[model samples]
Structures are given as C-alpha cells and as structure tokens.
Target: MAKVNYPEEFAGFAITDTKDWNKPKYITYKPKTFGENDIDIEIECCGLCGSDIMTAKGGDHGWGSITLPQVVGHEIIGKVVKIGSKVTLHKLGDRVGLGAQAFACLNCNRCHNGNEQYCANGVTTYDGKYPDGYISQGGYASHVRAHEYMCFPIPEKLQSIHAASLCCAGLTVFSPLKRYIPKNLPNNEIPKVAIVGLGGLGHLAVQFCKALGADAYVFSRTDSKKAQSFELGAKGFIATGIDGWEKEYFDQFDLILNCAIGLSGLNIDAFLSILKVEGRFCSVGLPAADEKYNVSPFTFFGNGSCLCSSALGSREEAVELFNLAAENNIVPWVETIPISEEGCETALTRAWDGDVRYRFVFTEFDKAFGTGSA
Candidate 1:
C-alpha cells in the first residue's frame, strides 16, 4: 500500500555541512511525509542572518551544540500549498512569511500574553528545541513545514525577495520600534531612532523605523553605506569615527536599537551617550548565548535609562507586521541568490566576512517557478 504524498511534503534542500567548502557537497533535505497540522511552503527566498554563521559552527558563543549538517535559515518568505485539518488561521495558497521562533507552549504566561517568542520553552524554526526532541529545520531549502500559528500572510504588494529579510531582521527590530514609540506623542511623532549596524538587521531597522514615522539615523564604523542609508529612508547617517559626532546627537534619540552582533572594541559609553534622559536602549543582535558585555553602570544611574532585549515576536505581531508592510508599502533591501547555485558556499563565505550589501535571500523558487535545478 502506497501512502499518499501530502502537499506539504514537497522535496527540498537537505543541507549537511561538509566542513570543507573546497569539497562542497551539501545534503539537501526532503520531509519523509507530511502531517495534517503541517503547512508546506514553496520557499521563494530566505535571508542570510548573522546568527546563521554562529549557528553553523556550533562553538562557545552559547547556543550549545548546533545540529550539524542541518538546513540553516529562518528569515523566510514563501507561498503556501496546504493547511492542516484543524488550522483556521490560514488557508490554501496564501502568500506567507515565517521567522525564528516557530511554536511555543501556549499555556505559558508569555505565550498567553502575546509574547510566545518569550515562552520559557519553545521551538525555534532552526537550531532550537521541540517536544519530540526533533531538531527544527530552517528555510534554506526549497520548501519548509511549519504550524499555522507561526506563519503570516504576505502583503500583496510586497516583493517576495525583499520580504525575506523582514521575517527575522524585520521582526526583531519591529518589536522594539513599536514598544519605544511614545504613547502620548500622537501617531505622527514616532521619534528619532538610531540604529547601530548597517548589516542584515540594521538595514531592515532603517526601513522599519522610517515606516513608523521616526527620524532614522545610521551609525556605522565606516561611511561605506551612506548612499544606501539614504535610499532606505534614513534621514541621517553618522560615521562613528567623527570626533564631534557624539556631541551633535547627544540625548537626541528617544530609542536606540543596537544590532551589533559582537561587542568587541565597542565604545559602550559613546553609544549610550546619544540617548535622551529616560531613553531605552534595546538590543536585538545576539551573539549566540555566551557572548558577554559590560553595561554602563553610571550612565544608567545618571541618565535615568534602562537596557533591554527581545526574542523575535509573537504570532499576532506577525499578522500586524504583515498588514503594516502591505498597507504602507515597506520594502526590504536584499540580495537574491538561487538555492541551487554552485556559489552558495561563496555567498556563505561573504556573509561570514560581512561583505554582503545588506542581506542574501536564497530564492528556492527554482524548478517550481519555471526555473530548473536552481
């Protein structure tokens, strides 16, 4: 007897890190079968997050041992082919997007309060935990399987390639921007926001902050991204090395989103010096879990400030972000790559070296979208 092939059980990339890029052979994966609760996505694209590099190595930064040879991606955008029997949140053939944390224990306090990403124990789409001890996979391949709650419908106006970075980088920054906006300042005054990195997450933060009505600023170690910053809606750009830059914007930011993955040589005092009194400095850039940092003890006491961090976002937030992007026409700046291209290793290398313009979104739409082997 032959078991029927469910639509969600599409063949896709099964990646297994071969350790040596010179002899590159990746194990692309295909689900053995599909379940009713599973939704299959035609993985149109996936972004290259900094976390992906740290995760692939499985080192001391503190995510513990990553599932080697595992498909590595989470910033994903795609189209759906099927939904489960019990699923009511989504339907067949929806343009949807998914992010880092996939599912959570709904009974937990955080999950119940619309912060499922903070659920004490939850399943991340990749390099994370689940009930069955099965290591979750990611969107690096041609297709992906996820629960209905973890997905958001894509805005009709969004370009799928650009929408890919919005999942992780977009959501990570989105949660903080929404929280930092002053409640009484009227909708128009979204505040002056500064983003500390012009990489994968920082670029998206620029677009998001601009879309939210904030005066956006970009801070980079070098002035290389000034042109891109303007194109992405940044109202201002600051090169970190300018001798008097600190004095100019001191106390100017109501909110500062730090997207710096590593804090080495980071002028913590200098970065904090720009915040207004009672301002919040929120960080979304994480270096695995073992990375360490020193908070400015005196700055907090004197400036009346606090520091915080966020873990992705909730299912409801996903819906809101989806509609927001749709309504306002926010566009993410990204570089596209075909999933079957031989240069994937090269792209991963460049991403590791921090050479990618903003992000690398793997277009897994090959074969399925009138393209072949790619």
Candidate 2:
C-alpha cells in the first residue's frame, strides 16, 4: 500500500483512435484522487497477448462496439509503491502483478464465486470501460493505477521479468488444468497431456502440464519446435502434417489442449481420434476472422467424450499457479521489447508473421513525457 499521494499525472499508453488496431499511438494518462481500494504500481514488464491485437482492430465481442483509442496491455508484473487507505492484502513496496482483468461486477454471482472473468459486465484491464465509464489502460507504460481488488502480490521466489508474463498467459492454462483434470490421479496416471501450438499460451501450457506431472506432448504442423519442446520437458513431439502419423498415437491422450490459431482445414476427426475413451478436447485459440470448423456429432459421441472451454482462472487460482510454478521451477520462453515498439501494427505485424520465438513483452516506463519507448 502506497501511503503518499500520487502525481496528478502519470505515463501510460492509450489508443485514442481506431486506426490500424496494431499501431496504436502512445498517449499519457493522469489518474484520479487515490481511492481507498486502489493501489499504484511502477510496472516492470507486460506480455503482449493475442487479444491486444484483436481489441485494436475490434472483434466479435459479445458486447457491442469495441472500445478503441484504448491502451491494450494486460499481462502485467510490477511493484507497488503506493497503497490506498483500505488495502491490506498488499502493502507498499510489495512485488505484484495484474492480469487481463481490471475490474468486475463483484455483486454478480460469478464474481462472488471467484469467476470474475465470466462476469458479464467486467472491465478488461485494457481497452475496456468500467461500469462508471473509466477506460482502463494496460501495462505498456511505466505505472499502473488499479483497484487493489484486481491485483495480486507475486511471491519473491519468482523473478519479475519472468513473473510479468505469467499473470495472464500462465494463468490461462493453469485454470483449466486445475478445473478440468481430476483432482488427484495416481502418479502413474497423472494424465497424458498434449499441447497444440508452441506460442505464448501453448508454451506455458507445456510448462504447466509438464510441471504438473503429465506426460506432456507437443503437436506442431512441422517439427521445427521439436528440440525446444523437449528442452521444456515435453515427453514427445508429433508433426501432424506428416502422413500416417495419427495411427501411432490414436487413443493416447487424456486431454488435448488446442492452442493453435485459425480453424481452416483443421483435422477435427484426426485430433479427436487420438483421445482415449472419455477424454476431453479443449481450446484457447482465437480463430482468424470468420473462422469455423466442420465437425460431425460423432466427434464427441464416438469417444464417450466432451469438449470444455475456459478463460483465465480465478484470483485464488492465479496465486496457486504462481506457487506451482515456483515449486516446479517452470519458466516461460520469452522475448522482451521496449514499450516504444508501437504495439498495434508494428508489434502485431511481427507477431502474426511468427517473428517472435514465443512471447513478446513490453518494458521500461517514464512518467513525465509519455512512454519512454515511443
């Protein structure tokens, strides 16, 4: 909790216009009077997620009209330098992090039950408006002022650079694994897990599943990521583009996590065929514009299985995720960039081109003169 009053103005990134969703012009934000439940953090790092790009150009959000000229960062890790009068869960100088969520309708049953992400009227940390119409910026700039209710203290055991990316991407996979997988399977049957795609979320999924004792496997269109996947402790790798490969691992995995993007030509029949009886197929991939699949009913019924979907997990689950990562020594494969990179068009163009090894992060903030990077 920061005791002193904050500067009337602070530095942050804002997308004030809906131009190219990728190349957002940087802007500054001056915060309101320090609220009793709000704490200000000096950001250390933020991971560039796929949604940041989507929000910039706009997408089929269940809600109407995508908010633009909105700062588009969410995966944030930083240290609290100020605390509100009523905040006790965290204190001043404590290392902490915030995810895609900024505020939620706590009065709703979802928030009351700890599933804040599902709240219908939730305010995203970036490019969203609270019920009061305050547009929430993200971690692309130097400092973040958010309600303490939406933040968590990252444990000291984890390093800040690594900790920055996990608040969201790390939590994205951890949530479902804890919720979907059996609570306590025997060591031998820890559940054979297969991760599709090897990007930001996919890579973390591999680490989370591997550290959780699953015989983790990686599936890519090609074998290019084979060595890196194994280095992350993957037990096996398969290239789906190769012919006659599906027969080798048919009915093998207990849980198949699809992390790849775009659904065109997706071999639904093939991927499902690899699942054991009563196995599950889950997805976190955001398909390209107007993407769809052609799956027959047999895909689920034939295997005595079903499909499940999840967003990021609860606040409690996020903490548990950090604990698990610390205990298991799991770390994400990441590439850091200065916030000056101009996120929307330039940053996202590179991302879409597969220019990033795994994840791209933004760092270094300056308050007086907008973002130091751009």
Off by more than 4 A, model 2: 1-6, 16-19, 30-35, 59-65, 183-187, 341-346, 367-374
Q: How much is 329 displaced in model 2, in angstroms?
A: 1.8
TM-score attained by model 2: 0.89
Instruction: List the candidate 1 regions with Cα displacement exceeding 4 Å.
Output: 1-25, 28-36, 60-63, 186-190, 288-290, 368-374
C-alpha TM-score for every candidate? 0.88, 0.89
TM-score of 1: 0.88
Once model 2 is optimally superposed onto the true structure by TM-score, how far is the C-alpha of residue 79 displaced, in angstroms? 2.0
lDDT of 2 by residue, 1-374 (tens): 11112355555566554455556665656654467888887777788888776666565421224665566778888778788899888888788989988777678999999898898987777766666666777777667788786787787888776787788888888888767665465565668888888888888888888767677799998989999998888889998897767789888888888888766756877888898888888887776556667677888776876676678878889888888888888887777676663533566778867788788877554432333232
Of the candidates shown, which would achieve the greatest TM-score relative to the real structure? 2
Q: Candidate 2 — number of clashing residue pairs?
A: 14
